[model samples]
Target: MNENKIPEKYTYIILTFTLISIISCIILNAFLFYGFMASIIFSIYLCRKSGFSIIELFNMIKRGLYECKSLFILMALIGAMIPIWMSSGVVPTMLYYGLKYMKGTNFLFSAFILTSVVSIFMGTAFGTISSVGIALLALSKIFGIPNYILLGAIVSGAFIADKSSPISNLFNLTLETVKIAYKEAITSMLKTLLPTCFISASVYYFIGKKYSVVIENSNINNFMYAINSNFTVSPLILLLPLSIIIMLFLGIKMLKSVFLALIAGIVVSIVFQREGFNHIINAILNGYNINTNFVQLNTVLVSGGMISMISVLLIIAGAVSLSSIFQETGLIIPVIKRITSKIKSSEELILKTGLISGALTIISDQSVGIILPGKFLINKYKELKVKNCILARTMADTGTIIAPLIPWNVNSLFIFITTGISTISYAPYAVLCYVSPIITFIFAFLHKFQGRKQTKEIQVKNTIK
Candidate 1:
């Protein structure tokens, strides 16, 4: 008999209790505290039933805590760096130039592409959505674009970059958890992401047909003037962040790269902003505020700080703790086993796993969706003789891309709260999010574009020689 096994009724009880806890946490806005407590209790219960001593449970907690230390430290550093960079005029400079380039174009597609690029650079969907996304929303009102379409385009663009960004925490988390090379994971993602982005861009282009306007060369000049007048702009400032991007592409660890880039930004700020050391200290502590004559530029530039990310950090910690408990309690194992057992074919397995992972985003959050499922599904794919690349690709497509589709999910909620755009309004325009999983499933089932055969052929030739 399995010591951890509970009666079927008790399993239902646990599930029910967990659901109630989660819902209450959400309703009461106490998700962080309640989630942490619930996780601890569940972990204790599981360990006790499994015949583990309190010391063993404490050790497990300690080990789990240690495992997340690096991630926490990285988060804190990023939290600090965001405001410093903002105050230094780096983000505002990008937005200023970005808006200048967008003048008198198909604004929808332009917004989509611009946000996509920036989000990719930022490696954060929420950051992209909050910064440039808010600007685009304001632009939508000015240009008379339908609100739903604008919302869709914004979400589509942000997710396109978010899904494919090498610097994204989810991207790195998935690669590390699956033990796949980061380059291979990115390559696999590109295979799925590029096509989905093409479709989404096409959709936005056609939708914006009526709104297309020819940009006069002078209009571009005026846009540039507007940006320059509004914020203290510098091109060299981008070099610091660009170096990090180059380093990431060259396979440096993300945390180290970010840390170095952040230091470079601080140095630039000290020199360029010409603010006193105490002023820099105050900005880092309380957040940065940029007051510009241009309200739009002011809005775009006003973002990021150590204080801003505390809420997100708390939410992440709570969600991760609950996820750890769910894992240790064997709840997820039964679910994974049941799903994997039903998968009779490789195609079915891939599709099933993708859908399950997508569904899990509603409850488990994106990190858990990829990390937990990626770990379990990778071995299953290997045993099935399915290519690990395909599994990794599917995980990226479904797990990372689908988060914004679930209204209550963290990413979606963040956008909804920040942009005041409902998930329902944005659902149709977010073609990449909806289409990626479908495209991935189609390829998996139809066996299209599979390079694994070539890999296998080479392996066989080597063996025969």
Candidate 2:
């Protein structure tokens, strides 16, 4: 006879133990690295108790890493690409033109849209925050807009492309985890993204009416001048981001696209900006560095390198190991099945997925937040006839977007460090973060009605026959 399976209650204990371990690190302000390690240890204990041998557990981890091997390589390429783009003047050039064309009338509205554009190009929240976000906050002081409200809009826009951008690590991770195609993921997410952006833009416009300040171009001009002085500003640099996007849409692999872009950046840095070959090599290894008289501009221009990706890689490895253990031991299946048994409709499923994602994001940072929920809930989504694109979109809608809203989360902490404002202070006004989930759920409800309508049409045709 087969051996008896573990009780359902054991699943609960495992999940609770894992969450507590991770949450403790956040509470104590310890590195999340320690938290992941603790979770890994506890998960190993659970796996062993369930009769998994050490070698079997190792194989599980190896299998998970194999699945994620592409993501690791892409992340490292992004790491190298960022510094090259910075040193090659691609980032600075974009910043120059973005600030030059930024609307000064509806300052709040302008801040949201402009930051969204920059974030789309930069493909990371922290980088966008440190660069355009810093400059926008400085302008907010001049326009007399509240720092909190402006920061809220900035943060909102900074994350718009987290799920949609081709170069975004978060986007790729969600895509890779769900095994969805790039085209499908983008198409699915846009359904929610377009509406949220419109609503957010309108809200900011109306709010701008509450505060009146004349548009002063001098402050903006100074920023442009500072950027222009540091590096060459040209339309040719636009080719770097454009090339990656073009190749991605044409079905080129993400790794090849990013790698090609890195090569292009190197050439641009050498031929256009005239950066020394040694300086370029150093940037790829360590990170780009620069010194300038403009203190504000100096901070934004420097960052990125392969070395900067080590911590992220380590965290991903640990999380993947933990996820593998859960999969191998079969502990999480019973838990997911039990919870999903109560889910009656597609809308309910989407709602619960969002809630789970939000909870995970609260307990862990963005990476683990997306990783765990995607792993656990994907099967239920398939059972419900839901497309994996929706699963990817939901995780991005809830976990990835809501991350910076939490005060102690890593993304929030980085925002605090960069902007010197508390997360709670600005979170209320981060319209996109709040709007995305609402819009997504609204779409879910609409999807349900559409499904019902289709079923009725099929029934009518059958009766006529």
Candidate 3:
């Protein structure tokens, strides 16, 4: 037996071990850290049996952590940046203006579009849902719209940004793991994203026709008063987000751009919002707490802090450690190779990738879904000469968005908690959640057809020659 080769049965054992640990943790409502640790220890034991020493395993873990150091810092910065934006009145201003736009229109379609826009800005599906999503649900009663249908639209829209937004932690994490540039990933994602959005919007537009109801001016007035009374809603506050975009377009790195935005947010909070230094500092380290008489508005305004990011960071570290052993000890390569060897074309590989990602999301959460698939399939992607951006985009399209459709997934649970809409109720209406994967598969098959046509043309030219 080759000392270097890990037995195939070990791969199955490792996977079974990982699955049990994750599922057990989920059922126990325990932090995923415990599950991750158990898998790491089991993998280390398996790696030792395959001839790797303890020192080698330690080095692997260290290298994995070192590679993720920048990601950790970026995550922390994002954590701090969000709360600062909230306390600085930037979020409130955007919320105030975004809410004002919900005047006599197709409620379902408008909910989808508006939530998509806000989710992009906020970069948090939970935040988008708690704020605008809840607001829309309340209005659904007046419009005679089914709460489930409206929620489907809202959940669909909220997750759109979670999957694609530059500021989204998951989006950033996916890109980092796949080693793809942001601009390239976004460009590739748009091929599927635009079509899905268009189709979802059209469906909601016609469906919205049946539930048109005039908004009472008083409801709008109350919303305005609640926001305006607590925070100074100004267009000037929009400059913070714009500044980040301008910097990014100017070739500034995401880290520097976020840092600059955080600084700008601090100044705006002090100058415009009259936030105290202590409050700003507290928001940066802990989280922003908005004190308001309006409970609805209060729910939206509160959230964010560097501390909130620790759980995500821990998960990343654990996943990376697990991935590192697989990479270095040759534990998983055989199984992955066997799988990829059957793939005849890039399109097929893309389709398989979507299936794997969706399956992972069903079994685990979005972070694991993205990280493991990207790590496992990256070599196959490189071998096929397909750009990693496509892989990243595919994972985001399937894994990240599919979470909300899974009833037991954390994403769905959070949505249910925030909006009181169950996954079963809203999932059918979350058209984009399903449409994205279908669009990706279609693109894959379309490319395959195009490739065959080109090959036939080449053969004909050779015959003429």
Candidate 4:
């Protein structure tokens, strides 16, 4: 207690306690939010033991929640937008066109590509998987493709912009933590991501071919008809989703775009879908539900509303509180400091940074993961003459996408709860998520891991050649 430094003994006790708590939660099939809440209580007790007063604990938790306020706002807005869009026919209409165009063997491949685009505009992997990703899986189910492959494709694509989109909070958090320019950070990540995207596309293409099935025109008609009877489908409602993309590209912030889209969806739902004010109000509060002759279509078509985000909000709150306590107690610092001391070569540095950063990532939010690593390692990177951009990119390569692989992590938990795909089954096919670290590691070995714009570009070009 006198050290105020979180001595080695306390460190082991905290680590052991956290590990056991998480493992016990997993074995019990507990909701991850509960685990986070438990972790927070444990941290509070630890903080009190380590010379913190009740007032100080309250302030620390408040400060942590304040940092996460923007994310909390964006998530609530997203929750509001989902049901509005669904009732407006925005979602079903998109699915109709997607199915119409991306027919047969191309559907699975298209699902992968489309989810990437949707994830960027949606600005969260959870939103992409819950809305459009659900539709894609329904389409694949109708076509008789194995759920595992299509589910894998959906999860993989949903993560495409978890760390690169102009409007993504995770992307912003990474840049802020690494102290890099948005343009530069995006450019660096794209360099590593683009190759993986191309490779994953090819992989999905081949795999899709093996299981592709053709639906008769009648089946397509029935699909559209089911949606039509439930919600009025229109091309005009399409503008809402498209505006989100345009607004993001124009440098408008994500929440503003979400507001714009939400209003648009409301207007369309009222006018075209013949929705009453009460119906729209219900949609905003409770979400949209549509019933159809087919149970599968029923599952896919029903979604959205502000209320659905309650559990997610709770998880975020708990995660942030847990992260705040870690920051306050100096618990994470000693572990990171120890890792920093072991760095020898640039490759090991990059590899270990990725591994350590990734391991920490699943246990916390993206902000906490990158902030801790960047705090502990940026100076070392400077000593090694590596660019800070490489540090940012390496963090994403290891830490960013792997969140969805950890079944207990919030990202994976939301994906599993929404999509019903077990993490273990879909992880192997989340090609880009796993491929990214491998790509970064290869870049490290080739000595192409600098953030220097020109030199790193030249090295990467040569390595690619």
RMSD in order of candidates: 5.9, 5.6, 5.7, 4.8
lDDT of each: 0.68, 0.77, 0.78, 0.76
Top-lDDT candidate index: 3
10 residues in a row with least lDDT, candidate 4 = 1-10
Error of 2 at 141 (Å): 10
Global CA lDDT computed for model 4: 0.76
Pairs of residues at least 3 apart in sequence or in different chains that clash in candidate 2: none
Per-candidate TM-scores read 0.75, 0.72, 0.72, 0.87
Give the Cα error of residue 104 in candidate 2, in Å: 1.6
TM-score of predicted structure 4: 0.87
Task: Kindly list the per-residue Cα lDDT of model 2 for residues 51-102, writing each as its tens digit.
Answer: 7777877888899889779867866776687678788887777667655665
Ranking by lDDT: 3, 2, 4, 1
Worst 10 residues of 2 by lDDT: 1-10
- The residue pairs that clash in candidate 3, if any, are none
- Deviation (Å) of 207 in candidate 2: 5.8
Distance from true location, Cα of 32 in model 1, Å: 5.1
lDDT of 2 at 200: 97
Candidate 1 lDDT by residue in tens digits, 1-465? 132454444444555666677667656756344655674586568546756576755655566556667656666666666666676666656655555666567888888888788778767676566546755664564455776788788888887655667677777777777787878777777777778889889988888877655333224454457567654687786676567657766767667877887777777777876656777777776676666564544544444456655665665565555555555545555566667876656878788778767756766677667766777777778887787777778878887788888654667656654555667778877877888888898788566345457668899999999
